[model samples]
Target: MKRRFNSIAPSTLGLALAAALPCLASSTAANAAPAAQNETSAPPADSRRYSARGRGDRRDKWIHRWAPVRNMWEFGIYGGVWFPSKHLELFGPTMSGSGSGNQRLNTVAPDVGLRAAYFPLRFLGVEIEGGVMPTQTRSSDVSATAWALRAHVIGQLGLWSVTPFILAGTGLVGMQSASPPRGIGNDQDVAIHFGAGVKVFINRWVMLRLDVRDVVSNRAGVGEGLTSSPEILLGLSFTLRPKKKKARPRDDDRDGDRIVDKDDFCIDVYGPPPRGCPQVCIDDNDGDGLDNTEDTCIDDPETRNGFEDGDGCPDEVPPELSEIAGIMEGIQFDTDKDNIKSTSKPNIDNAAAVMKKYPSIRVRVVGHTDSQGAYKHNIDLSQRRAASVKRAMVEQGVEDSRIETAGVGPDQPIDTNETADGRAKNRRIEFQILEGAASKTVKKRGKKPPKDELPVEPTPEPKPDPTPEPAADAAKPVDPVAP
Candidate 1:
């Protein structure tokens, strides 16, 4: 059998080995895969339905101005056919053939490759590639196998699911092993390669690739002097990328209610609704829009007439409660809170009693706050405080329809905000009695108060003799008699 094998022509032997390589590589690859991933197993995500969010839209100027981080890595296994061109056969003379020059190495052999690449930029990548192929000479039956380890640089275009790229690289290739077991051949040569490929990302972590390359080597001492060859491969790749963390801006919540403004309906004030706002005060026990921190009558309902109001309470207000704060004196609220205090309940009742006594009075509740924290938060707190006060009166028989509410926060501080006591004084609520057209309906209707109850009007300073008619200008006014 040995003699017969040695007697076979080199051409015949090389052809046989060239054809056997594909089967061997395929079998090896198949056995290397996990048993569960069989031919009939499910495939990966479909490329037809694959897309990244906002992948192809117009991007902002700042995005294009700077480089984006590239964290994706690619690893793949490829198998294909390589055919050396006619000119490549000039590397060495044919062992056996009748011709003026040796024919080119024409054997079509299978090449197997392992590739790993990193993209530092979105459109560019650097790759490390290793491959092995069964090689044959065209002039005779001489045969060998070649292996290579190379470094490549590639450029890609079109940022989408399907991307096309061009590559160029250089490396060392060995044919014939130093030890018989090391490889199929012992000869080594330096070579360069350039190619193009298309990558199809099925998802963020997997892709399919089709690659073609042209390799050049100088092997004049061997079968060919100068060689250039082509390899066409198909491969499946596994992509690696780090998980992205979401970013949130500090000012996302304009009103520090812990709810982001994008979803908050009451962007300026706080309320209760999913993605709307948080409950205002968190102390409105009576549902009368009054918080216990400031409500004088924390036990009653400041319920609205139509419930279609956002001013802390319902529309019904007692007429006699002309000034909301007047009914409850010495009303002091804790800093940053809006709940009505337990100690102020009687004062709240007194205010309610006074309103019931004077049914015609209209009350206005104004909220105040010290300059201890954010101005905006202070404003909201004051408004809530005032609303709670009104709720207290409304619960104690006061009409919800007749009361008016406002919050000035620290804007109208009556005392110095720098001192604790001053701040405390500044934070006190004020109730002002209103007469005449203070009511919205009354002002719109142009009605005057009854004669029996005279409206209090502030004394006005008389004009100072109209500046004595501006003596010089008055002297020129005699033209009125000319007509």
Candidate 2:
């Protein structure tokens, strides 16, 4: 039984695949182009030159476009053969005689039916049907005739134009057969059916269909049999009402910004900045005080001052500041102090040199601490650390006031400080542009500056202290006993 079932499995799967081909083809075609007639409209001559400018724009529109066949109802008809696989038994009193010999009679049978269906949802529908067949067997010793009335509820799945269906229901089987004497019997039974088929839309009002159905039934005293074997059917289906026209695709890009404006907060502009929408026409995607349209160092804001042409990008590497800062881990510092460790100096210097090169660009050096310390202590510590960094830059020839300092105590840890590693990771310093000095320089130059002169160092301050002692230290007594 298992082998027989397996043998038919491939054919059954093939039929299912064939039935689904139409739906797959339709979906592919729908996605390949716009549902609208002008899916591939050509741009006007003037717009062609600015095509690159609007790439972000077109993509925004495509995302919001609607599909053409979203909500439409379809109706159709189907027909098939019914091959009976078992016999109907007729019982009567004493076939020959109780003492002489006992006998029983049975007859072979066949059946046929009609099919109708309606779709209430995409890829699904319900079907109602009825049919008839004969159950007479040809023999001199005995003869029988059977008639059945069946009503089944069918379920259908649409794959493009093809639809596959299954059905199950209860019906009455009336049997009549001849032996030593004529006899009749009526029994209640059940029928189960499954089928696969395809529908071809001829127009808005009609469709052509082809299908094959297999049916199995249970008859009292005759066991179970294939009441309806496979049958090839061809039929026509008439639509009861005209379907509504599909809506045109929506334009997803809401903002004129180059980015595809999808669920973007900056609905009017495109933003390349992570978690932000572009608000201005300027192309500064990272919001690092450097506009990508003008900054050569768009990825590294620190290098913005080292480049000329107000494009906040770097042109040359400073010998003293060759080390790269780890933005992900942040700048490490000494315990309870704003002073960056000697190991981190190279990275800080690199950043400072970049700032010095762009004299006009100023940076905000922010200090953060782990939550282990008191809030006030952490705040003071963070501020002191920020001040220390600024002082170091000033000592390295950066303008005294060009660097802004701030302390955010244990408030913004990138990781939870409940663990040792996380606390260590949270103690850090970061550089942010307070004002775009590169943009200012470009504006002052009146025109784009030479790329070679991009590394314009800030005018050096004379003997300025890079680090300032806390005001509390200055007021403290040299010795506690002296006070």
Candidate 3:
């Protein structure tokens, strides 16, 4: 049984190796899984790929999505078998005779290999390696040994804790066997090897690797020419350099919007719930004056009322109420005349219509004049003219109580009084729609207009001559004639 086992057929070993590979791969996957790291070490965005961080810059990250290792050095020890494609024919002394002979060698033999690699960059490395194995030209005959040494360039790609690499190298190979009636000397030659394999990191410090190499040598002490031998090795490697430390995104974004954190007013949150950090959904739109954080009504458009309209909302003013300034060009008057002009009718009609439409409106109809007349006379004229205009509007069905009249004389001219055009422009009328209807600035509550500004009362009608007590009333006229 020992003799049978030692001479195991080549076909049997091939079947055994093929059956064992999948078992090794499955075992490696099961044991090589990495533990989750702290949140500080996790990438900022994707869970798989390295975090790209800022915009546009995509270089300088791990080559593998799941492999976290960067630049480092690795040292590994490997043990495997070298199988010859064709039987190696060795020229050596025959065990049965005292003469030299040749015999084909085909057998499974064990080999030991060692490797040292330097990874200067992420995906590239250089390795120096050597291996030795004892050999036999004939299965039960005299045994010999072969040695190989190489310097290889390694190119690697890693994915999800597994790194696969390919190697190409040129090296030296030697085979020697001595034990016979005619001892065989050493056969040495230059050799070239190329193959590929994989490495699985069980952790940062330890990894498992498997390599396959095909070595072509011109000088195998064989009677036949060159020999092509393939070798397979599995190794466990240790890293000499420490694992790299990953960085987490900074806490500078307090609002979770990715804006400068210090610039945010409503820090630590995004409004309307389900907020913060992982997603930034807020939008400025630039429609309102303020940013979304400061806005109370975030979606409402600004009123543009020239107020603090930045709250992303329009001012709440009634549709019927609007400033009388600049609309319909304000009321205008002829020089020294307080009577409503035909051109002014359209404006008056609009004002009356506004009042009729909304009963809450109270208006001040003010009269102004040029500086041509005496100050006091102008004051009185402006007053009467304003009163007369009020009466005309009262006739047009506006409520007298809703209207207030004022005469500023030349005190408030809208234009220069030195020219005719200025004088004409100066003598004008204005309808100030009181703010009690909407905003607070138009008029103050419960405050009366100045006493001096109230319109003068109209002259009283004379009573019918005291109903004559005829005779007695006639005596007074007669007495003057008689006396």
| Model 3 worst lDDT run, 10 consecutive residues | 271-280
The ten-residue window of minimal lDDT in model 2 covers: 59-68
For candidate 3, write residues 118-232 as lDDT tens digits. 8887578899988888767654565767778889898888544588889998988766777554334466668789999988877556788889988886533536476678998
Give the runs in model 3 whose Cα sits over 4 Å from its true position: 1-68, 84-99, 103-106, 179-183, 219-225, 241-249, 252-483
Q: Rank all candidate structures by their TM-score, best first, as comma-separated numbers.
A: 1, 3, 2
Best by lDDT: 1
Compared with the true structure, all predictions reach lDDT values of 0.61, 0.51, 0.60
Q: What ranking emerges by lDDT with the best candidate at the front?
A: 1, 3, 2
* Candidate 1 Cα errors over 4 Å, as ranges: 1-69, 85-106, 136-143, 177-185, 219-225, 249-483
Please, what are the lDDT tens digits per residue for candidate 2 over residues 1-483?
Answer: 999999999999999998777557545544443332243233334433222323443322222221112234444444444444433222333443334222333222344455555555545555555544444433234444444455555455543333445555555544455444333333334555556666665443566767566555543243544344344566777644333223221222333333332333333333433422422334455455445545555565433322232454444433422332224134667665556778767766777777766566655667778875334445567777778877877888888887766667677778877799898778877665434333443322122334675787889878978998689658855776765
Q: Which TM-score value belongs to model 1?
A: 0.39
Error of 2 at 300 (Å): 62
Tell me the tens digit of each residue's lDDT in model 1 across 19-135. 777557545534543342242133334311212213342221222222212767889999899876555423433333353344344468788989998887879889998888876
Displacement of the residue 445 alpha carbon in candidate 3, Å: 42
